[model samples]
Target: MTIAVSTIIRPSRILTALVSAVAIMVASIGLAILAGRIGTLGLTPRVLTGFGALFLAFFGFYHGVRIRKILQLDIAGAGQIRLSEQREKRTCSDSDWPHVGKDMQVMQLMPGSTIWPCMLLLRLRAEDHAVRVVPILPDSVSRESFRALAVAVRWLAWQSDSQESSYL
Candidate 1:
């Protein structure tokens, strides 16, 4: 009998969002105060402060409603993968996806960019031509976890290949 093993990995997105909101709020308040100090602190700074406050409010809302990342993987069988992220939760499984993240990838991040530094983005194919982008390894995390995930994917792919060949 073939045994199925479940592997779970969680990522930090809600906390990240909260931190970003706080950082933006601080910047907004600082700039607003600086602008107030001068008779005319220039239009540029005022505009920036407005944008920052708007973004801060948006992130604050997200932070309040943010949920945890939860992924369930069954690598021993038909590439069953379940994901619960933000407000979208769904499960996908098929022999076609023998490997859950066969196309998993990562991108190097820079400071002051949309994503924090040293983070990797793993892209998984979702339903109907859409893609699910997951951010992992927030900052300077070891690559061992990434390797482990890759190995599990490869093993699942092998299982799928063998199953197909056995039928043929």
Candidate 2:
């Protein structure tokens, strides 16, 4: 029997806030560490910290904007997964030759992939060797669809692990 789950993922405000918060925290820590060493760099602590703060603010904003892409994901049975961006126009300078609006047969689920009740981090590798990391949050999809996707992804991961172990 084959279980297929398809879902359209929207941008989540929760994720944006989370990413921004993390970026801010890291930036603060980095600035604190750099504060002690600014004397050797021949720059005043106030000037260095001010520039660093501005740079981190821009960095956080950029990443928050970058995560707002709409996507369509399909998990077919226990063996196939496809992902495509559903953007109205190309936003980045990079070519969208293979995956944008097209199905990509994922060859592997790379490391650092995790499934949590509130979020799912899918690090997928396509047949062409391109890798994409997809972050899915509960607010990104309908409640029922989110539940179904989580179940399907967990089942797929389990099935893949079992099959690999059987071959070894």
Candidate 3:
């Protein structure tokens, strides 16, 4: 007899969005500085650089805010993996989130025992997927969910009739 337990992996999109906003703000400020310096070349250069910097700032902020509303990570139980729009079909994959999630798939998500809030790697046995290295996001996911995910993975491993298992 075999019982299947379900685990939902949903890191807060709100949190990621917030981080992205910060990045956008920093980049915008950096671009503004660059424009100010490049303005020394000539009035034409100054106007062009200033316009470009403003465009970058606007584009960055617009995209950053938009992602929060659409970011989706539906990797729950088996066959439940789903990526939202703007995530799958995109030209410039400058946003690291999409690329990061691409390598993940539904599988025996053995997130490891003793998986501290330090590092994590999820691998799929399917022919269509590759290993995804999800680094330590101590605060990206809620503490409880992270622990629960770890427990689920460990439980599956232990139930697989493995003798050399330790999850305490």
Candidate 4:
């Protein structure tokens, strides 16, 4: 058995929102700077740009801190994993997977071994193929969980194969 822990895949909603907010901020700042240089632009443009920049800064700070807090939770670490078995649902499909849990960041579970702190780019062995349980958390999960999840996943895959073969 190769029991392991698994986390959710990357490109999470929180991350998407963060990126979009950042992009808007960048655009607003750029526009503000350009308008200031042109000197012909009205005060309204400057005011609106300044407001946008302010909102971006406020929201960015708020979201960043919130994400950090979520990352600190254990459930968040488990939530980050996306297993091959639950690929269709796209996020922690097995609500009852042993020791498996999820939050805004990580995916937690036990199969055969533990896989923890699995990065969004991290790839681990699955039951039938190699799958990447990308880290959706802004902060990385615990190293221990990451390793455990990997082992458990591999073990589960092995067990599944054996069962299928036996049935045949």
Candidate 5:
């Protein structure tokens, strides 16, 4: 089985939001300064305000880099997730797109579902800290991919059974 590790890229929305926020804040401050609205505090306050904005912008840039650099290894544990056969009609869906290293926050989204859909059972405990996007997108993650991921994680975990793995 070719178990390829998928790398999580920083969400474009995050970068866009951060950049936009910083830009707006800077623009507003610049406008105020241009309007000759400097307070009695003088140049010190302006300098401090500029520093604060710079710090915030730097933080946003660094955060994006951190997100891209973080690497997680999924290792399986002895525990196995159990699914009910009756819940074959229900599909495991998530409220939103899942980040790379986060908890599985999935919900049963099939309407009038008497049982969980069998298609998503392979994803049961397959990925570590990986949430399913099936809820948001019907085919974001494939069943075969999930199953292979599970098997790979379990194997890797077993190899490092003596010590706690970084990604469990």
Candidate 6:
């Protein structure tokens, strides 16, 4: 029998902290490099430093806002998957799945999706052929739910591969 799994993804403090730490490190190295090349680039120190500060502020704001979305993901036993973001929910199946909302569109699991013990990187493709990447960290969900999700994802990937091979 196919496995059905549902997970509610909360905002992950760990992920946020990690991102912030990385951004800080990157900004430090970037400023260092800019400082070293300031004379060669023919730009004044103040102007170059201003540009660097602006870039760092923009980067921090962008990522800070992007990581706050709460997600609800469901995978049915029949290989149907649903993803809900805020009040908008979309479902996709192996074949033609009907639309669930006015703005809802089909989304399928794409290749290169990775599931690790601590994280899951889901690559999803929409009906409009746009790809979206979702990251799930351990702190985002319960331990039991995390383990179940990993197993379910692996099974779904295996099922998809076998089905594709059979068509050949």
TM-scores, in order shown? 0.42, 0.72, 0.39, 0.35, 0.30, 0.75
- Alpha carbon deviation, residue 133, candidate 4 (Å): 12
The per-model lDDT (C-alpha) reads: 0.48, 0.72, 0.46, 0.45, 0.38, 0.72
TM-score of 1: 0.42
lDDT of 3 at 49: 67
Residue-level lDDT of model 3, residues 35-135, one tens digit each, is 67533556666566666766776676676455343223334333233333233423322244233355444444334433555433444333455543333
Give one digit per residue, the lDDT tens place, for model 6 in 1-168. 557776667778887887777777767666765666434454576456746765885688577768688776777777676676745443334354332345443458888999888899888787778888778888988898889888888888888899899999
lDDT of 2: 0.72
Cα lDDT of model 2 by residue, 1-168, tens digit: 555666778888898887788777766655754665334454576556756775887788787877688887777665577787775633322243234343445556665689999899888998889888888888888898788888887887887788889999
Candidate 1 global CA lDDT score: 0.48
The local lDDT score (0 to 100) that residue 75 gets in candidate 6 is: 73
What's the TM for model 2? 0.72
**lDDT of model 6, residue 118:** 88
By summed lDDT, the worst window of 10 consecutive residues in model 4 runs over 69-78
List, residue by residue over 1-168, the lDDT tens digit for candidate 1: 333333345546655665667766766675565557524657777676656666676667565445345544343433444443322444333444322454432221112222223454445554444565555553212355444445544454556568779999
The regions of model 4 sitting more than 4 angstroms off are 2-40, 70-118, 121-139, 150-168
TM-score: which candidate is best? 6
Clashing pairs in 1: none
Model 6 earns a TM-score of 0.75
13 Cα displacement, candidate 4 (Å): 19
Note the clash tally of each candidate: 0, 0, 0, 54, 7, 0
Better of 1 and 4 by TM-score: 1
Mark the regions of model 2 whose C-alpha exceeds 4 Å error after superposition: 22-46, 88-107
The lowest-lDDT stretch of 10 consecutive residues in candidate 5 is: 106-115
